[model samples]
Target: MIIVIEPDSDVPIYEQICNQIMEGIARGQIKPGHSLPSVRVFASDLGVNMHTVNKSYHLLEKKGIITIVPKSGAVISSPQDFNESSFNRLKDEFKPLIAESLVVGMTHQQIQNLVTSIIEDFTKNQK
Candidate 1:
């Protein structure tokens, strides 16, 4: 997975990592049963503190997106873990942003087109 971190951003580094990991799962770039890099190894690779990666991994585990096994490492959870109620919850959470996007000159067609392209690209990359 490719992660781009903005140090100056208000979000914490751990959260940034967590968000990217979640996005990777959502896009199917990382499949269920796939193991993620060791926390220490991933932190070293990203030039971040091990605690940062650990925090992100723990967060994923709490969210049911991953499982943390001692000595075995982190593994992506099955897609069956995600439910329609969770998606509805996410949609309700994004309601304001969806309205804001509409007000910001993003037409419905334009938004649909963008999402379609994003999904297409994600699928292509997953292959």
Candidate 2:
């Protein structure tokens, strides 16, 4: 739930928000069914515009990571919500990144090790 925004970074504010939220979920800091702060409150806390937070929340919703309800705010989606199409879409998205790594002279083993390390770092405390 700790999100640091670098105003001077190349990434957009809304993307930074979305990435941090996704990372929080991956690290188990934000569990499934957890409710996110209201857009107004989150924007106030992050010192960003409410529209930025809204855009981030909507992006997360579009990716099936969270559900936005009118009165209840945003809730993390459960694992059961993911399906084969989601897996395929994610695989397709990763393809170019993997290809880029290879083109940069990164060996397959090195890429796999990096992925493993990241997964371990994120899930270590969950169990």
Best lDDT among the predictions, by candidate number: 2
Q: Could you give candidate 1's per-residue lDDT for residues 16-74 as a string of tens digits?
A: 99998888876777889999999989999999999999999998897788999889999
* Worst 10-residue lDDT window, candidate 1: 118-127
- Candidate 1, residue 111: how far the Cα is off, in Å: 1.9
lDDT of 2 at 121: 95
TM-score of each prediction: 0.78, 0.95
Give Cα-based local distance difference scores for all models: 0.87, 0.94
Model 1 stretches astray by more than 4 angstroms: 26-28
**Among all windows of ten consecutive residues in candidate 2, which has the lowest summed lDDT?**
1-10
lDDT of 2 by residue, 1-127 (tens): 6889897899999999999999999999999989999999999998889999999999999899999999999999997899888899999999999999999999989999999999999999896
Off by over 4 Å in 2: none
Scored by TM-score, the top model is 2
